[model samples]
Target: MVERLTRAVLAAPRTVLVGALALLVLFGLYGGGVASHLLSGGFEDPHAESAQATKILEDEYQRGGIPVIFKIDAPNRDVTADPVVGRVGKQLVEDLKQYDFIQDPVLSIWTDPVAARNLISKDKSSTLVVVPLDGGEDAAPGHAEDLAERFGGERDGVRITPTGQGKVFADTNTQVSKDLFLAEAIAIPISFIALVIIFGGVIAALLPLAVGIFSIVGTLALLRVFALFADVSIFTMNLATAMGLALAIDYTLLIITRYREEVAGGLTREAAIHRAMATSGRTVTFSAITVGLSLSGLLLFPQYFLRSFAYAGLAVVVVALLGSLVITPALLKVLGDRIDALDLRKPVRRALGRPERGFVPTEQTWWYRFVQWVLRRAAPVMLITTVVLLILGAPFLSIKLGFPDDRILPTSHASRVAMNEIRDDYERKLGGEVTIVITGSTDAAVDDYAARLSKVADVDAVTSPDALFVDGRAAAPRKSEDRHGEYRILTVTSNTDPLQDSGKTLLANLREVAKPDADVKFTGTAAATEDTVASIYRHLPWVLLWVAVTTFILLFLFTGSVVLPLKALVLNLLSLSATFGAIVWIFQDGHFGALGTTATGFITATMPILMFCVAFGLSMDYEVFLLGRIREEWLKSGKTRADSDHAVAFGLANTGRVITAAALLMAIVFAAMMASQVSFMRMFGFGLTIAVLMDATLIRMLLVPAFMRLAGRANWWAPAPLRKLHDKIGLSES
Candidate 1:
């Protein structure tokens, strides 16, 4: 099949190249504006109670609870009765009222003084203005940015800065865009130089870049299509470009190197293309399938933020695979022999007074010697490697998971700074109110429910339509926004940090306080966090099962051996566990202060699951590359234990340089993400870089070879029925 495809491609290389160029242009034009269509918030499960309650609040109550909450500071400590403060505050509220998008009667010290007191800071120098915007959730961030541009900063006697969930989302999206550009600027040039050095020819190096560009642009266009039907996050852009470039380079390098080897072995150009496509091209197909299946595990989760990654990941894998199999082979056929033009390795060797080495004998290569040393003491190598990986992964045992917040941004960010001040000096933190809507309940029942909510530990106040309840007592008649439709609304405010354990516990206790059969719903930061975590836990098992089962079957089909698949799964998990542990230590436990962000004491819940899928697929990508060569060598040599060992050494000696170079190049691309200001991006960048390096060196170099050596002939063993099944349907070169 591969030979036929190669012939078809070789027969019409120009037509293939022209068609590819046209598609690239079309994809570029359509995908250029994809970032604008992506959503800023997708962290909530739409089926959860919080989401349902939020929809009710939006649709039934006509209330956009909070706009961009602004922190206003005055020169005088006493805000009330201060002439300048009152004038500036009232003028700002009036300015806000002019915009129809903002909800009427913006609260300030002067307008609705009763509610404004709750918003006043403890020091009396600062107060918050609550201006609710009518725009829906998708447009809230844009509205916040517009408000910030017009009404934020100094006005008359006070300084106002926008700070809330809306503002935070806007700032985060902006940062993500900046980080994506920066990561690319840093990664691409370095990658090209490394590729040139690794491929040792300018023409060969350019092929990877061609494939990378094709994959990224194509995926971006595909993501735009996805955004039409689903809520795709802006964060997907970062992963799309990163993975697209990495995978493009990976598949291209593997195929091109195999072509060069076949050419050097006295094969004709067409035969070389056919053979390379049959072996390395098959590897690319299996690699894409494994990576795509691993990413598909994310679909089980309800959050679009997580699901969006799956979309981007799958798009990149598919697009890169297509480019590698279709466009790359066509380009290789046209550039045969000339692919070695503009030779760089020979010049470097000449300058260094070293002789030109075309291809070193396999027995004398460094990888061969290294493999021999490892196989001689395989038991100790495997034992020591496993122990080291386990030790690195120990910190993950204590990991705490939670939703992201303003803290995910850098400390100097305005949103985070405002939040810090609010947490420190305000009696009631802004946007920390848990709103409950109860249907089919009488006013008396609601009053009692409000009193119960006010009695919970750490509860600051619970304001219902009737009165404000504080510590189970009716403090005063409160004219609030809680009265809407036939449903009774209760707003519960507390000082607990909503992204912390205390916040989640408070939400749980509130839910428990509600009657078992009552038609009650909760919506707030804490409620959303609780629901999202629960959703992850509920769907987590299915994701793991899908990844494990599909990956096992694919590997089994590829290797025609049950033992190799099991070993690959175990090694990949071990490598990923260590990566998670390192992430916990650095991002969660706050061990690395140099990353320029404070530890939140909890890792973002979606990160671990996302990382596991991405890293595991990448691990298998390398595994397929190594094992394909090993299996090829094994089939030709004797079927004895010594022959198996010889095959392992020969495969390693042949493919070790490509794998190492590919790993380094991939690591460089991800390492550039360490420059991101957002803590999660930095953690992702650092964690994946560590994972790739460890897998390439520790697991692939040490553990895999050691295990294969120890297993000897057993590594290729399979049951009679399964062997026959594999012979019929397996993906192999021979």
Candidate 2:
């Protein structure tokens, strides 16, 4: 199969070159506007999930369905009751009271009746106000926060805590935009250097980078179109680019390495390219299929965000795979010796002539000795590592997932400074954040319930709103109209995290307190954040599980051996688990000092699973490149398991230096993300770097062969009936 692919790569070098060029042109035009024909940027980045969700909420509000809530909090409750307080405080309170778009802030003390009751506070020591914000179509919500700075009027104690559709949109956009650029900035330089170093030849390395870039552009363009039918998140867009870039390098790495080997073996440039392709191309195919299948696992999830991410991710990978195999081989064919054009260092020449190379891979190294030692203790080593991973990963078992309280912060950020002010100082005045619900019977449930709600909890405040119906239409008081019943607006406050456990617990209590007296539903930033976090967690495992299983099957089909596929699954998982531990250790546990950010309690939540899927796909580079030669030896010698294992390790030793070099290059690319201010990106960058290091060293260099030694001939065994079937149809490396 390898020979066949190499032949094909050699056979039609121009066609492959042309196709690669075309894809580049197409994708460039699509994203950067250099290529005029591929412009796909009218809407939001189609892969960014937060953008899609915001759009949905926008649509809901526009339809006159959900009332917008605008919450305000002022600091320093004590030094009150100057004439200026009545004048400025009353005016600010009045402005919100008259807002047409703003609905009753269910638990605010600043609105009409609620404010009246709370402002006097029995001793008349303080005053408060709730404002209704009803900015119609395309209200620039960011402007509202600005309103706070304006209304506070150089005063320290008065402030507004905005919470409405506009705030949500503003916060989401702010976060996504920052991460996107941060990721690009941190990744690109490191990635470029990694590419240059790994190839030793500039053009050779750039090809994969070019492929990855094109995939990013093309997939975004494709996603823009898909957005008509699905929701995409801003976070997902950044992630897809990262994913595509990593995968493209991985695919190209396998093929490039194979092509170099073939060229050295004396094939003409074209023949070498073909032979490399035909062989490495199978690896590419299997690798792509595994990655695609794994990402497809996101589809089992109910959240539109995950589903959208899955589809977009899958599309990018397919395109990257195509570029690696169908397009890349052809480019290699034409480039011939020029593929290594930037070889100013004369590395190959130095390598071929010298024997003093400390860098060259050899069994005499300490690493080789360590592998030998580990091999002798394989069972014990494996068992110990497995137990360690399980214990470290145990935190996930008791995991409580929820959207962040300060969604805008990585917890270290300062926008959260604003939230701290509200939660601490503001809560002293009102025991908790308020949740206002307008409730009533089918006749006048909303109005009556509003009044009932005011009287329910720590109701120190009351907002007696004028009769407001769900729609603008007013019901006749004496008529049989359902909306004619009395409606009173009320606000109640409580203390809670609103997104995490304490918040959820408080919410449950609040619900139980209010449910018996009125027909009411409590939905606010805190509650909604909980739902969002729950949604991601509820579906994440399924996404990962399906991705792994599907990757297993895809690998099985590619190798045509059930045993080989199972082995693929195990190695990938083992490496991934170790990676997760390292991520937790570095980012959450702060195993290292002052990583330049406050350590959140856990590895930035969503990153572990995403990293797993990504690393599994990338790890296939070693799996295919190293194992290809091993399979060849096994088929030829038909020897004992140990012999084949030795052959594999010997081939690996030959290739190990190059692959380890590549892994180092790649690890640098990932680690560059540590330069980002965004904590999650840093976590991802660090975690991936660690994972690649382990994969190249421990797992690939040591564990795989040691296990193969243990499995012996059983390693190659498919079921007996399946053996003949595979022999009849399978394409073996042999």
Candidate 3:
């Protein structure tokens, strides 16, 4: 198959090259244009949900625009009718109007009057003003920052602080943008270096990133076209670009690495390229299926965040596979022997200039020797590694997952500043507290039950329009008094950190409180956070289980041995776990904080699980690539397990360096994402880097051989029934 592909590509190298170039160019142009469009204008402010809601609220009530709470502080938390305080407050409102982001700031006590009780704080020091948003739906604080600066950082005699739903959205948009871009930029260069080390040739090294970049840019174009028809969030685009780059580099590396190996094995350049396409291309096809299927499970959760993410991820992966499987093979055909140009000229050349012929046992083979020594000490090493991994993974046992927060930022960010500021100023309002909702029953007993809740504490004030008021946050509105009546609402606040407690205590309390009331349902911020975590966990088993099954089926067909498929699964899992643990330790467990973010005990709510399914599937990709070589050797040697192991070992030793290089490259690409200020992305970069290192080092080098040695005769198992089926339908390298 490879030979055929090689022949065709070589027959028209220029044509093949040109065609691939054209495809890449098309996407580049389209993506650039689309990206330019987005940059030129702006997407509607999804963050300003609250600000938008305020306007709607005002319109409904026939009142004014949403009121902005002005926090006026004297040296102390004093609110008074002090002449200076009143003058500062009045001047502040007037000065705020001069800033365009501030629609209109009314100063007089008349509009928000003392009778209206618009004085939010006890000391007549602070007051609320009604302000309309100045721009269209896209208006944000980022656009207003310059204007604010122009008017002087402080307004009037008062320090200007903006807090509300609109401000929150503007803040979220700014921070998310910084974090994601930082990670994306960092990922590319690091990944490229890793690739260079793997391929030993700049051309081979650059290929994966090249393919990834093209696909990424092209995907943007594709999505732009898609965007014309459906509503796609800008956030989705960020995620898709990331996934595309990572996978493109990944899929490309898989295919190109295989192609180079085939070339080194002495196949004609064309044959090598063709064979690589036939096999590596097939691996990509399966890989894409596995990734797509795994992501599908996210849809069941019903959050647009995850739902849109699923679609974007699936699309990019598909795009990545197409670029590697189709476009890469053609390029390989064109490159032919030139693929080895650098190896022959540089390190290989330097080593070959000696009488030893530059052929020395690789570190993998050397590590195999170390393993032999370790086998004598295997019990201790195994026990020690196991203990450490357990200790590393233990944080997950107490892991607390919760809704997103500013802690994920670098703390220097405005988002973090704003979050901290709000938390401090409004502990009374329980600002940023998750909303607790009991939806099941609207029975009058609900009010009596609610009274039970207000008494349990963490209830700053509770108001039930029909029900009695106990303390917690402001008066609870009747779920029935409005459409919200069918749903009773409870506002809960805790001094304890929600993410750290894992939100379990609050959830438990809510459940316990609702138990006596029949048909009780509780939902709120803490509830939502807990539910999302539970939702991830609930779906994880199926996702990983299906991934394993899919991998086994694909490997079984790819390699006619039931034993091989099973081996890949076990070995792959070990690699994944070790990698995950290492990352957890480094990023989540606080092993290294000076360089970047410390892990948040629990990684971003969904990433560890996502990495598991995707990374494991990807690890299977490299596993199959090299395993195929070993399998061929076994079959050729008349099923002698030892001979096959040697062949496998030799193949691994020969290819081991490149595998490590590729892993390093991909790790670099992933690590570059670490530059992102966002904690989720930062953790992702760290975790991915660790996973690649584990696969390329421990699993591929040591564990694979050790496991293969253990499997011995059984390692080549092809059951009679399956063997017969294999004979009928299997695709063999031989």
Ranking by lDDT: 1, 3, 2
Q: After superposition, how far is residue 550 of candidate 2 from its true place, in Å?
A: 1.7
- Report the poorest 10 consecutive residues by lDDT, candidate 2: 34-43
For model 1, what is the error of residue 142's alpha carbon versus the real structure, in angstroms, after optimal superposition?
0.9
Query: What lDDT would each prediction earn against the true structure?
Result: 0.87, 0.56, 0.58
The local lDDT score (0 to 100) that residue 390 gets in candidate 1 is: 99
Task: State which candidate, 1 or 2, has the greater lDDT.
Answer: 1
Using TM-score, give the best candidate's number: 1
Q: Which stretches in model 2 have alpha-carbon errors above 4 Å?
A: 1-26, 32-110, 113-172, 347-377, 387-398, 407-414, 428-492, 508-522, 525-545, 582-594, 597-608, 620-622, 728-731
On residues 1-734, what C-alpha lDDT tens digit does candidate 3 reach at each position?
A: 44465456567767876877788788777765553222211221222322233343233322223223344544443444556656766766666665554543343353544222423444444544434454432444344433333332353455545443344444455555665567667777767666666667777776788778877777777766755654444455565666788778767776776676666677876667677777666656665765676565545433444555566667787788767765677777656667656653476666777542343434346644554454445345555554554564554444444455446666775435544554554323322233343445654655666566666645433445353356422253443232243454444444445555535575566567644444343444445456666666766676667767766776777678899888777766666666666655665567767246645565556566656655775576568656765665677676675575566665566556556665666666666666766666566666666776777776776666666666667876887999888888876654
In model 3, the runs with Cα more than 4 Å from the true position are 1-12, 32-153, 163-172, 175-204, 222-267, 279-301, 307-309, 335-388, 425-429, 432-446, 466-468, 471-507, 514-521, 579-591, 594-603
lDDT winner: 1
- Model 1 clashing residue pairs (backbone): none
What's the C-alpha lDDT at position 299 in model 3? 50
lDDT digits (tens) for residues 1-734 of candidate 1: 65677778889998999999999999999998998889877878899988898888877776644467888887565777677877877787777877777765577767775677678888799988877777655778888889988888887767888988778888988998899889989989999999999988899899999999899899999999999998899989888888999999999999998988888898998788888998999888888889999999999898998999999999999999999999889999888779989989888999999998876678998899999999999999999999999999999999888888788889899888997888888877555679897877777889988988899988889988899999999999866667676777888988777887778788888887865235998888888888888888899999999999999899899889999999998999999999999998888888857367779899888888998899988998998899989999999987899999999999887889999999999999889888888888888889889999999999988999999998999999999999999999988855
